[model samples]
Target: MATDIPSPDARPARSGRRSGDSTTRTDILVAARTLFGENGFTKTSMRAIAAEAGVDVALVSYHFGNKRGLFSAVMEIPGDPVLRVTTAAAGPREDLGRRLITTFITLWENDDTGVALRAMLRSAVNDEGAATAFGDFASGAMMPAIATTTGLSTETVRAIGSCIFGLAVMRYLIRAEAFTALTTDDVIEQFGPRLQAIVDADT
Candidate 1:
């Protein structure tokens, strides 16, 4: 048998995959943070993050659930939008809207989580990629979770999601004087019924 020989310009083939170990998680986070900082959340793809981390693309999803989840992890968002929204839906149907509004206010008013969330919203307003990513997260994950928990139609859940998203922009991001002047209770009182109407109408 002839011995195999490498060509002069050939190099050793290498696999970028890292062993699935405790450090793998940390590696992905580090990679994600670096890429996110360089390219921003909208520009950074899950595959790019995985390649940067030398891990499989599926590994990123395995740890963070999806692109938005990975972004939340990299940004150190206190709690995820999905978790917060789903938690709000855990109560009685009549109270769902109020609970949702309350949860949104509590989260957006927090020092740490609020800052990160504000950044995300501002980015979406200014960047097309970020807007697309935000829309995907809201429609793909957030609305589905709410629809499942509340037994609402997709259309109804989407309407509620849209309402909540607009709430964030007006009250926090835009700082519309009218909206910002209202106290949290005022917001819940006024907006809760709007969401309730959507849910109630879905019959």
Candidate 2:
């Protein structure tokens, strides 16, 4: 009978594979975000991101499809717009305005979400695709959700989107003096009721 002994340095292949996969994906995202911030999206390519991540270029495509998908991943908005809107909708219909505003505020204040949001917004001004992407998500996903929740018409939903977008612009984008002077609670208390009235007025 012959006995075989494994080498001392040998380890489980599966565990090593799992660790590498996790680390690689995270590295790609970090690299992409850094480069996107420094050079903007169009200037950054898969190869650049791959080099920064110390991985093969194919791996970028494997994980994130293309720059658009990768940028979307980097944005990492919490629960996605659809999920967030649906969640806000689940609460009291009468409370939908306040809940939705609070939800938007929370998304805007969180570190990761807020950073990506501001980046996307800033880029959108010069980049049509970015503008369309953000606009579509806001108008397409969120508007309908609010309309459905409050039983409001399409026009009313646009009004709701306008208000929320303006709020984000004032607080996150421009940091307007008049809006910045007020606290989050103050904005919520003052503006929230007016939003509620829009929903309430719809038949």
Candidate maximizing lDDT:
1
Candidate 2 residue 182 C-alpha distance from true site, Å: 1.3
Instruction: Please give the clash total of every predicted structure, in order.
Output: 0, 0
For model 1, the superposed segments whose C-alpha errors exceed 4 Å read 1-49, 56-68, 74-76
Per-residue lDDT of candidate 1, residues 1-203 (tens digit): 01112223222223667768788889888876765555555456777777777777678889988776786776556667778788889879887888888888888887877888888888778866556656665666678888898899999888887788888888888789999999978988998888888878988
How well is each residue in 127-148 modelled by candidate 2, as lDDT tens digits?
6555655555556556776677
Residue 46 in model 1: shift from native, Å?
6.4
Q: TM-score of predicted model 1?
A: 0.73
User: How far does residue 81 in candidate 2 sit from its true spot (Å)?
Assistant: 1.5
lDDT of candidate 2? 0.68
Error of 1 at 201 (Å): 1.1
